[model samples]
Structure formats: structure tokens, C-alpha cells
Target: MHRQIAGKLTGPVTKWIVLVGAIVLVGIMAPLNGKLIDVQNNEASSWLPQSAESTKVVEQLTGTVDPNDIPTLLVYHRDSGLTTADLAAMDEDAKEIEQIKGVTAQGAFSPNEAKALIASGAKVPPLLSDDDKVAFVAFTFNFGKNGWQDIPDAADKVRELSKIDGVDVHLAGFGGQASDASEAFEGIDTNLIFITLLVVIVILLFTYRSPVLWVLPIISAGFSYMISGGVVYLLAKYADLTVNGQSQSILGILVIGAGTDYALLLIARYREELRRHEDRHEAMAFALHRAAPAILASAATVVIGMLCLVFADLNSTAGLGPVLAVGVGVTFLIMVT
Candidate 1:
């Protein structure tokens, strides 16, 4: 059965058809592959399980508290005691910060406000340290569901506005951390793909010991990656599958790594068959017949293992399983075809 299937797949007309069809499918899916990053949800809450205490609290507070509100703290420190000029600059910064689109005016406190609350004898957290060497401003930003994506820009604007001549300014709190994280994940997909491809190419060249032969597996891996990404993008965009930077990065590595492994196995078998059979196409057919069962079994094992991740409590982990399974499954199909 395997030999018959392999023979038909490698047949002159059918083989061209499969090759052309795969190339066209990849071309059609190229746009979707590029858009995978857009649907990624990197917000911390997205990673938490729905039943988690924090997730539950967030849901409970949805009506009373603005779930989108992110508390941000801007801290300024001077080795030398903050001068009059520094205090004045902070006051100006407060005014400008309030003008930022998402910044909440209510409950925001700057150095000047702290001084008034102190004079009024109202108990409030000190804006300035006892030594007067450090001060901070507090504000809230509410940018709705996609607020995390906008945080880095907002933080940058705040940093620009709050610059004090002699004081060190730092962003601290949830918004700050979110901004930092967003920055860290930026360009993750591109960087990971390039690095993965380069490493795979180098390793393949070393393993195959041919300058040109390494390209075939790399091309196959690239097709698998693109196809998997496109499928994942569709799932996330329409089916509401959660795709994060972590999962997307993992998908690229998994597809490339798995595809390369399968290619090596199939090619090794083809090399052995070549010496015994004069016809290259017949040799390939025999190689595929012998190798297909092992490849199918290995891919099935990996796909099943990844699917088990669906039971994980964390949303990210649950989502990761299907994402990886799709990648490996796609790699298997592309490699054998």
C-alpha cells in the first residue's frame, strides 16, 4: 500500500501537480503568514487560566474597576537632593502627562499635589523621599483591551515629558512592566525565523556534506513554517485561538526542526536505494515506501503529545498545544509530499 501510494505521488504528471500545487498554496498563504504577529495577545491576563484567582478577581472587578486601567508610577531620583528647578520641572511634566490621551486625570498625584495634601493634613503616601532625593508621580492609563500594545508608546511619551535635568527618571509599576515586555517581544518572530533558518542551514550543510543539497530541506521547512503560520493566523483571527509571541516562536522552531529531521530520514533512505536501483524515480518510490511508516509514526506521536497540552489550566499552555501540533503536522505533510 505504501509503495503504491509513493509510486503514484512520484509519478511524472502527479509529481509535477503536487509540486506546483504546494507552491501555489504557499503563495496564497504568504499574506496570512505575515499577519500571524498581528493576532498575538501578549497581555498578562491572556496567559492566566480562567479559573485562576487573579483572573477571577479581574472578572469580578470588571464592573466596579476599569479593567483597562493600568497604574503607572514615574520615579525620579537625584544623588544630590532634588533642587527647586527639579521640583518645578516635575510640576510641568505632570501637566503634560495629563494631556496624554489615555492618562486618567482623576486620582493622579504629582509632587505639587502631594505638598497640598500634606498641608491639608490628609494622610497620603509621600511623593518625595524623606531625604528629598527621590520623588514619584502616579497616574492611571485606560486604553481598553489592546492597551498593552499601546503601553510602550505611552511610556516613552511619559519618559520624554518627565525628564528632569539632574534627576534620574524611571518607569515603575504594571504599565512600565508591560511596556518593557512588549518591547522585548517586538520583532521576535522575524528574529527567531532568521536565526532558526541560519542554524538549520549550517547544520544541514554539515550533515549532508553537500553545498547545494541542504537547500531542499530548508525550502521544505520554510514551506511548512509558512503554511503552519497561515493556518494559525486564521485560527486566531476567526476561531479565536490564542496566539502569543511564545507560541508563535515555538511554532517556527518546531516546524523547522521537525521538518529537517524528517527530511534527513527520507533523504538517507533515498541515498541507500539509489545504489541498488538505476532509475532515480523508482529509487525514490522505494525509499518513500520504506520511510513513510516511520515518519508517520513519529509525527503522530509528536502531534498526539502536543494535543495533550490542551488540558493545561493556563490559557497560553492550552493554546500552545494545538499551535505546535499544527506545525508538526504541517511539516509532516510537506515533507512526505
Candidate 2:
């Protein structure tokens, strides 16, 4: 039955139909995928790291805390020990930070003008650290995971004013380092994705040489991308899913790699049929029939591999694992159709 279908298509018409089908599939998937990822990002960013202020405070209070994260510290010292000039500088620094986005709240260390706080005998330690060397500046930044985005530059700016001559400033925290790493990698990621897409396009053009033939893979893969995204979004809504900045990279890789692979397999079979037979419909049937099994097998293997990641110790990746797996599964189904 499969071979009989392969006996129909003559040549050019076989190419045209496959090309059109790919475009249709892509058109169907695009909008759906966009919505999925947007929702996924919003949901993840909203939930975990819930108490942004407390989280910042927790980071500040800890010993050996990484300076890159936000923390709320009870910075205090003898009123006599801090000069009036230094006090004014602290206020200035705090005000500048207020200009940053994602800062939900901001405040600083000021001796409680309230007689109750002063009277409570909680023992505001003068010279807040050992040997008078280090003291936490008591002001918590109103920040969230998203607020962390501005942290590196903010931290750098803080450090510039935070330590005047004769003041030892130490920053210890949780959220800052991750933000720094993200900022550091920003340029690299941009370059890599752009280069990767270029390479993929070049490869596609070289392999097919024909504009019409090249469109087959692009269109098919475009459809695969959209549908896969929709699957990710739906799972993120229903199941536990974490889509981070890395989700874009993961989705891009899966969509480009798998879409191209599926299209290639189907197109290769179609080409073989065109060479072997003379009728268009028959070639379409033959190509789809023969390619169906291998595509299914490859897709299944991909699903299996993705499932393995669900067992990962990382909460983020574990959530992502199932979402990505389902995405690939959806893409595979579209390819076969």
C-alpha cells in the first residue's frame, strides 16, 4: 500500500504540495505557541520567591551570604560614630535606588525617632560588627525575582556610594549573584541564538537548493514551534511548571532541531518517491506512509529522553521536563498530520 502511493507523483507537483502543507501547519501553530510561553513566564515569575522583602532580608542577615543577593540588614552604630555627612550620603543612596523598577519598597537605617523602639532595650549594638569593621546598612529593597534584574548595576552603584573612605562595606545576599550571571551572559546568548539561526538557514538552503523545497522545512517547523508552545503554556497552567529565561533557549533548540528533522525525513521520502514514480498524489501518500514510522519512533525516543529529565533534582528543570516533553510530542503529531 505504501509503495503504491509512491508510484503516483511525477516531479514538480510533488514538491509543491509538500511545500504548501508545511506552511499550513506552521500557520496553525504560531499564535497558540506565543500565548503559551507568555503565560508560562508570567506564572513562574509570580509564584515562587513569594515574599520578596523577607527574602531580601533573609539574604542580608546570614553569615557568609553571597553579596550578589538582596538582604535586609539591621545596620546600626553609635550616633556619634556616624558623621552627619555620612548620614546624608546614606539617604541619597536610598533615594537613587528608588528610581529603579521592580523595587516594591525601600527604606534605610535611621534611629527610631519613636521613643518606644529606643526604649525597647533590644540593644541596638553600636559599632554593629566586630572591631568596628563591618556593619549592615539597614534598608531593605522592595524587590522580587524580577527586581533582581536590576540588581547588578544597582549593586555596583550602591557600592560606589556605600563605602566612603574609612567605612568598610560588605554586601552579602542571595538574589544578586544570579542576576549578575544573567546580565553577564546576556550578550553571549543573543549572539549564539542569532548565529545558530543563520547556520540553520544556510544549511537548509544548501541541502535543498530550491527555494520551494527549503520552504517545506521552514513552514513545517514553524507550525511545530507554535503548537509546541501551546502545549507548554497549557501544562504550565495545569501542572507545576517553571519557565525561566532558559525556557527560550530550550524551546528554540527543540523547535529548530526537531522541526527540521521531521521535515527532512518526510521530504527525503517524498523526493525519493518523486524520483521513483510519476504521479503526485501517489508520491505524497508513499512519502507520508514511509516517513510516518520513523518520525514516530524518533519522536517517541525524544519523549522518553525528556521524561528522564522529570526526575532531575532541580525543581525548575523537573517542572520544565514534562512541559518540554509534551511540546515535542505535540510537534511530532503535527508533523505526521
The list of candidate 1 runs beyond 4 A from truth reads 101-108, 114-126, 143-145
Model 2 misplaced stretches (Cα beyond 4 Å): 1-32, 35-84, 95-101, 104-106, 110-120, 123-136, 142-172, 185-193
- Candidates in order have lDDT scores of 0.89, 0.59
lDDT string, candidate 1, 1-337, tens digits = 2789999888878989999999998998878999887788776667999788998888888899988788889999999899878888888888888888889867468887889998999988879888999898888988876675778898899988787776899999888888898898877877988899999999988999999999999999999998999999999999999899899999998999999999999999999999999988888899999999999999999999999999999999999999999999999999999
Model 2 CA lDDT for position 246: 64
Per the 3 Å backbone cut-off, how many clashing residue pairs does candidate 1 have? 0
Best by TM-score: 1
Candidate 1 TM-score to native: 0.90
Worst 10 residues of 1 by lDDT: 104-113
* All candidates: CA RMSD (Å): 2.5, 7.2
